[model samples]
Target: MSRAKSPFSPAAVLRGALVPMLVVALWQGLSMSGLINPVVLPSPVAVVERWWAYLLPPDPYDPAQGSWFLWALSGEMLFDAWSSLYRVVLGFAVGAGLALPLGLAMGGKPRIYALMDPLLQILRPIPPIAYIPLAILWFGLGNAPAVFLIAIGAFFPVLMNTIAGVRHVDGIYLRAARNLGVGRTTMFIRVILPAATPYILAGARIGIGTAFIVVIVSEMIAVNSGLGFRILEAREFMWSDKIIAGMFTIGLLGLAIDIGMNRLNNHLLRWHRGLEN
Candidate 1:
């Protein structure tokens, strides 16, 4: 039997690293060649150095120097990261919590679909960023507005995916369940939900990416602390290295979240994979 390839294998690791390594090399070359102004776009090395300094603990030897580092740190990188993470989690939870049930109901019942679909269709096309002013007005300048924006970003993707998943459940499964005299609740719980899980998960993955994007945008305006806020603050000061560091931090965090979501998807869809195999 052929063994499953491990992502951690050296070959896989090398393949993954090649493009990123090449890009960095090109970036460094451009920086060194003085084609681009350092003030406009800092070198990757400078960004890395800034990130390292941002992560370091304050020096105890000279409190004044430590204060300078602390000021530059802007409440520490980890704290800002955690703040962004918390908003994403909370907002995503609220969005998914509402969307899942509503989607299921709409998908299962034509009446529900007819009643809601028109309004949802109209609203879905509106960008989450468009809601920023209203969100701030409604929730004021704090976590509330950021969370609201993130929820708005997450809601539509999840809702659409869930509805599609449920609607697309194979007709054969419904026939089989009905043939067995299964009640509506049992049929839905045992057959429809399982069949739709993969689609729901797919939607969730998309929603999470949207959540991250919305959270960052919201943080830039709605809240005073987060990676987005840091990036914006750096921009105001013309600190290109710090801005790049913050951008990289957000990228790394998004990568971590995507990896986690993939693991969850694998765990949940093992049965589906077995059937396909």
Candidate 2:
């Protein structure tokens, strides 16, 4: 039998688009009415025009800054984006890599839990921003500091979720695995990890978001160049539209990364679909 169409089908695209369209319409209306200052809140059309200008060359006054339209396509932009992205990936990886094993050990053994649980509890509540000063002092103002901040930001979700997942594993499954002559290591890999995959994926998703937050904040403070720096520069020069454009770009990229991660999680956890259904 075929399933019914989901409410969130392609038509939902139009439905979703409506809110932003209304917002833009209202904004344009306000601009025309002169109720809003164009300096602070440019019209939707103006923002679009500026965005287009940034994405394509206008009449060149000087050939250098004239290429502002090509900024998004430039090697510098790509490199900066990549540098920020790399920090996130590396930090998330480090956090997850360390957290998984540590969480497993803590959850799987009471002795380890007794020793480590208190520490994790204490540390987990500290905001990633709190670590920035120390991170800067320890790693200096470069990728190291940025990645360190990202790692700190990403660590807690993975650690906490993994511990929760491992703690809640079905005892019957553990018994069955042991009854089948599975070693502890084999049971963990074949049973616990698979069972914990959902929570792990959830943690990773949160971690990725945290990574982006850390990247932007870290870039703002401790880096010379990145989207954050570009935005700051635009603000300093009072290029309000460019600043707005940069913010939009950051939002779009962050959203794309999140959506991509969600898709990957769905693909990897297909088995969980049966249980949910």
Candidate 3:
């Protein structure tokens, strides 16, 4: 069951902020106190300042010599984030689309499941990063390889979860449908699909996370643009602040995405009692 709702509670927000604010305060104290080298571990504020440079337009009076550079830097952050997001959506959609039907068929029929299980077993264990070299060679860098890598990474979670969800449907449902003379297509549309929705959504959520992980890896090596590439570029310059900023930016985006997915899942599975937390 869910927890009881509280009236507009600043206390709840403060509770959530307690640890993070403490950590930030400690980090700032250590950096400013010179107890920790900023080069080794930049303070959160320093990292945020670096991100601001990459995200904000230049001050108009700062000098034309500097304004162009600031604008370009800001554009770089926007472009990289957009590129990565684009790849994640494309790859996740493609992979999930391909997974659903195959998984449904596999879960519904023993023979079909047997035939597909071997291939799934063989490929499922391999990390998407393992395919990078071949992906680069085959797709030859840029978004193609990154997209392919993301797709491969996102695929299995969805497939496996879909199959599991389908399998989880009560046998009584199937027997009842058959006794009612429901045809195969009608039964699948009215019964199987609804029963498997939760599993499919769970798999999609996992797939989204996987897509993000694989996209970063793919971007680091296969492509020249994205937050992953920005981090690598910062490393080349020995810009610890920028590197950490890029990392935090990626983490923040991933967290936002995960929250969005969790909300969507709860909405879709509102009737599913086991999902309540």
TM-scores for every predicted model: 0.88, 0.86, 0.89
* Steric clash pairs (candidate 2): 54-69
Error of 1 at 33 (Å): 3.5
In candidate 1, which residue ranges exceed 4 Å CA deviation?
Answer: 1-15, 59-75, 274-277
By summed lDDT, the worst window of 10 consecutive residues in model 2 runs over 54-63
Ranking by TM-score: 3, 1, 2
What's the residue-level lDDT of 96 in candidate 3?
84
Q: Give candidate 3's error at residue 187 in angstroms.
A: 1.0
Estimate the overall C-alpha local distance difference test score of candidate 3. 0.87
Per-candidate local distance difference test? 0.91, 0.81, 0.87
lDDT of 1 by residue, 1-277 (tens): 3554977999999999999999999999999999899999789999899999876654434555556645544447888898999999999999999999999999999999999999999999999999999998899999999998899889999999999999999999999999999999999899999999999999999999999999999999988889999999999999999998999899999999999998888888987754232
Off by over 4 Å in 2: 1-11, 56-72, 75-80, 274-277
- State the lDDT of candidate 3 residue by residue for 95-153, as single tens digits: 88889889999988889999989988999999988999999999997899898889988
Q: C-alpha displacement of 105 in model 2, angstroms?
A: 1.1
Angstrom error at residue 197, model 2: 1.1
Model 1 earns a TM-score of 0.88
Residue 234 C-alpha lDDT in model 2: 76
